[model samples]
Target chain A: MKEGKISLEEVKHIAKLARLRLSENEEELMTHQLNNILLYMEKLNELDTSNIEPMHHAVEQVNVMRDDKLKPSLSSEKALSNAPQQNGVFFVVPKVL
Target chain B: MTEEITQWSIIETRRRLAKKEINAIELVETYLKRINSLNPSLNAFITVCEELALKEARYYVDHPDKLVEKPLGGVPIAIKDCLCTEGIRTTCGSKILESFVPPYNATVVEKLLQAGAIIIGKTNMDEFAMGSSTEHSYFGPARNPWDTSRVPGGSSGGSAVAVAACLCPGAIGTDTGGSIRQPAAFCGIVGMKPTYGRVSRYGLIAFASSLDQAGPMARNVQDTALLLQVISGYDPKDTTSILKEVPPYCEEMKKPVRNLRLGIPKEYFAKGIDSSIEEAIRQALRVYENLGARIVDISLPHTEYGVAAYYIIAPAEASSNLARYDGVKYGFRAEIPSPDLIHMYLETRSRGFGSEVKRRIMLGTYALSSGYYDAYYHKASQVRNLIRKDFEEAFLTCDAIIAPVTPVAPFLIGEKLDDPLSMYLSDVYTLPASLAGIPGVSVPCGFSPEGLPIGMQILGNYFQEDLLLRLAYIFEQETGLSPKYPSI
Candidate 1:
């Protein structure tokens, strides 16, 4: 949690968690750029915000619920229209096990 | 006839269509011809729905009775590619969704169709609305119509240029930080970002969920207001949508800005702003003063922390929202010959997303990671509240706040491409309003000496879009600035 320079190893680890496979050049560039951004963002620590609550939503709208009703939705054909690889009803992906 | 049709506003086009001055098909053809002639150089539209637009316009032409009932009947409007259009490809300016077509229209798109506006095409934008410049687009950057060498500011660059260059009467653009306003300023058109919940975000490919709001961009304030009326309302589908009654925004323009208290945030005029842009905004303040509106100097104390906080909050949300694009259900999937599921996810994402998207995802993941959550994300959110409080307090003193849209003028196409931080800084002034969920409009105020247009942003309290439009309309009428067309 220290506000210091980010290492290439850290960038690679973060990218891995984000499910991104960055190249050697990207890893180096991301390390430098993220560190610069984080350093700039460190300015936020300057303000004393112990009393102020963190805002999750810009507007104060809570529990915006709609009536539960079964309505027509996209058909199987339309749902899988944009799938990279699909077999009419199911999306094809790499073997999990 | 084509020239006249291309220059008409939404209202003017509707009036002409109703009076038989121009048929719907003729109007559609006028814009289609212009798009074909200019889109090659400007790169404004990724997919021009010529046949679809014609088909819709012809329907309106044949059924004049139906055209009369619709507010935006026979009007040709372009949409930013991020907004989903049923059966039309909505790329969000990335190769990841290049071939993906939406099965259902976005809430705004559905509203536009109901209002009789023809969807001309899906315009270009930054890849997932991430970059300030459209250079991050999987498609090439949309060039500034003013100077082909310069960029029409993005990620709604294509939508802005389409309106600026007369490719479309008006276009819909979403603003997370300054995607709509900055681009509209750079292109010398009117763009607005309604209060966050004012417009539904159902089919808008989420960049930053809380910060994103879809609004209208047009050649003038009146047209912008008209288009906003057509698309603004409650949608039960989008939970964040406000259930407020949509006001007659165009009618509200008739009210004068005689005694309106306008606040000029002093921090925005500080250093880093180009001299010419500063001069133009100051001159605009003077014009408001002369028009009987009092301009008070105020300070948004937390203004400096806007960009820093926004970068944290927006990315964190984006990291979560974009996680859905893991090459499982839809979009681009890597053709890897391996039984390992994790490798496919990595390769698919790495190859699909652009550098900016990847950078944000990494930054977000780092911020939201186990130990760093309280440090980065939590701290940033607390600061975000402080920034919003600054606006709320400022509103108690003034009805609206006035400032420059962007600190600097539109730079060359590749000027800030390499420096990501510098590019992020461009949204410094506009980000505060977005963070506060306030409605802000960028009115074409004046042009820089380089002839690139400069815009002044007028911001109002949440759901005060009518006031923002009224103020911008007065400025537009007073200046009587003729629309400058880019000679392709």
Candidate 2:
């Protein structure tokens, strides 16, 4: 693994991006886990990729776009039928404010 | 006779359906009964749509003359709950959307229906396809049929288990990382993840939008090929859907890989691999050699970066994709008296998502959030590119890569539940294919000393599913390892 040290705060930062509110216990757990993972990845740092171009998709397809067209869509009433609560034409929920 | 019927392949089933030896209703009912009996132990299905399945079966029976003998006509298949099915619930194995039903069917579902396939039910999965072991499902973890105490690999665990247990002849599973292949390996079934963009994802719930792809899980390579033929094609609704013509997947199965070159990546064989798995793969390679194929040693030096890149890229996309689950839209709504919209968002998210999913979403959010995007998310994507490039370089000298799908055989239930890293290790060999958007197939190579299944992965260049399935088919025939069923 090529990478070095990762901070506890960095783990917290990544956790927040993940939308997880971790307990202190989890933070401690992830700090150890992520560090070990980075250590494993450090092996890649030894590889010489300076001459190689990065690969994306295996195939050489580019901009395989479809023509814009209108098609039938589900009615709002049908779309929101399973909503726990709904307003007319839209699913409803508790007011944010 | 009915038991024999349950064991037939998709092609055999289609032939029987054509000859009128078995009508659609009997076919559907056989599976419904099997599912009822075996699912208790496997926990493969979340909802059994018996009424709808029978209704569709009745239609097929009543109009047998009009049936065109479509590729998968009257074949019973299980679906991962993450794929939307019109008029049926699409909970994605999350309690947050327990009551959520979609008015539209996913593109793959629509394609299956058009081909006259009968859907048995929705199978269990990781909540929002987050975890590697279906343990994250609010419903329950799907068990390995070989040993009821063991786990079926997840996100697509239920799909694989259903096919393995003969509850359904085939099923559809989505793989973002190793969701499809890992579970298939664990359950001793055949699972294929097509090249990214080969299958349309219009209505499949997003995990990592860029990485998520739907594929087939079945008892054999031929059945997987048939399912792939029916469900694959370009869809205008999906902007990312490839417009390139899809090869006849079924016909590809009949093609032989005589004189083909197989590559075994050195990185894949590193110290982390189980010695037993390595031996099985070595044995399989000798079989390939006897079949007129030559083995080449190759190095994918960047293989080590796959999991790290995947964790970062997957979460970044997952955080954005799951944002739609807020109380404002059609998913789960929590009643919380909050001071502002932000508070409401937090309350709904906090209450709606599972712990693992929340953790990922937060990680993703932080990765993409201000100030850290370049350091974490962007850097990860660059590494993803490097990982993908590694495959390109290896493919330059070899036709396909053969390696162990997982290091170890199926572990007992709750074995890795507390350790997320251990669970993620199950996907190590399977993730590179997804990261590179290449086609990969997992075939049952041998059983562990404990009698649990072990699978070897065959990966091919993009759009080369023909080569992928052919290799698997050849091995299936040579080993004569086909037709092993789980004991009740």
Candidate 3:
């Protein structure tokens, strides 16, 4: 967890993985912000948590669930009303390479 | 008496229903009227379930005997749009789901319905619960009920505002980072984010699954306890949902606060915090001290890394969680004349989600992407473990931790909307609680000079919500500030 500098290339790469088409301005801004964030996280590296086992659950908890029962469902029309583009049961979309 | 019904607390509302002072229909009407009058300016609700709420209220009137089983019995409340309410428009404030009505109620919503709580409406939120301000919502930003020019700190902005404006006695808000607490703080209401797994996330649209939690937002501590009592418990549908024995949250209210230990994390009050907020927290600590609770100085050294660690971890998870919203599924579908799935996804997502959400999604996607996973996302999780440990150690020293919910009071509508970094900092004080999966309650502590609400957060140990509620109830009583509703 070294406090190494995060470059614009890293931001661009992250965006690509995220499938985001970021403009040049956003990439430049994010690089500056993300780097500062990393520098701050570097301070956390100084903390001694070696002896403490990593604790994920704040309180011990087990399977939380509901009875498997069919409940009243919404109409297909209502369900798809929010779709920006739809064709019957499927949502319509643009072409990909 | 007309306004009395609308302004009553959960207890009073129930009491009136029992005494037949006002029927459920009248109760719903008063609130509907208030919402009708005030919601135009506040923009607190995206989908107002007026007809359904009225229908439910009328049913309660005809079947009063059923009230015995319903703990929330006839109390009207709002649900954050992110939580799917069966047959209701459960838009997470994005155009992608703008017309989408969920086929099922989120587990919490079902629980609320069973408890006799009337579904008033779905409140607005930052689109996909991504921003500190609800400005990113496609519907429009929720205005602070106290001051229209200022924002009701969001993504639960609408829910908090609805409760604050007396449109609903209480509301449910999902917290990812500080969505619930920040808006609750800004709106000057009582809001609690129970231990991460304390409540089920079955129907809650994911922001960051690990960090997301749903909790009650109310006008006072006891109502929050009441709401929590109903909505909390184990749900198998949500894999991350914790199965734990449900405690009588309301029963804890009767417990007296004496000889309680409160911890003040010094790092939270460090440089960059606003003076007024610091003063408000100090004043609240004084109230706790006056109540005979021992206030001790404790250090959560890793607190400084909160905003940074949260950015990496939240986005990384968000990028993945949000990927399902592609055109093929239920949400916004982009028009790809050439019939390419990838192009459809890109076009739909690009057109559906807002800029800030897109930014975080991109950042998260990047962090979780190959080659960068270890350096960014994995490293952040490790740091998260350390952050959790910091609270564990602090709890060993004190019963609870008290701090300001946000660095400053609510800012103007457009104040930091453009500055993502500053907006990210808004959750600096509150993120640690979510990261560590601890319970935190934000109660109105004081008001700023310009008359904005300031809230102080109470952080408690895991499954220590009883202690958290008891302590908050005591402080709320001592301050005589529990029932002060914001002037609309």
Measured over all alpha carbons after superposition, the RMSD of each candidate to the real structure, in angstroms, is: 1.4, 3.0, 3.5
lDDT of 3 by residue, A17-91 (tens): 565656788677767666665565566556554564544344545654567899876577666665666776765
Q: Which digits, one per residue and each the tens of the lDDT, describe model 1 over residues B1-488? A: 67777988888888989999989998888899989998999999999999999999989989999899999988899999999999899899988888889999999999999999999999999999998888999999999999999989988999999999999989999999999999999999999999998999999999999899999999988889989998999999899998999899989976999999999999998889999889998998888999999988899999999999999999999998899987878788888775478988888889999999998999899999998999999999999999999999999999999999998888898999888999998999999999988999998888988888999999999999999999999987888863666565
Q: Give model 3's docking category.
A: acceptable
Question: DockQ score of candidate 3?
Answer: 0.36
Interface RMSD of each: 0.9, 3.4, 3.4
Evaluating just chain A, the predictions reach TM-scores of 0.91, 0.76, 0.78
Which sections of candidate 3 miss by over 4 Å?
Answer: A1-14, A22-97
lDDT of 1 at B130: 95
Error of 1 at B399 (Å): 0.7
Better of 1 and 2 by TM-score: 1
lDDT tens string, model 3, B435-475? 99998999999888888989999999888899889988988
Per-residue lDDT over A1-97 for candidate 1, one digit per residue giving the tens place of the 0 to 100 score:
3335678888878988899988899888888889899989989989999999998888888888877889999999999888887999898887888
C-alpha lDDT score of every prediction, in listed order: 0.91, 0.83, 0.84
Candidate 2: list runs displaced more than 4 Å. Answer: A1-69, B337-340
Native contacts kept, each candidate: 0.91, 0.37, 0.45
Docking class of 1: high
Candidate maximizing TM-score: 1
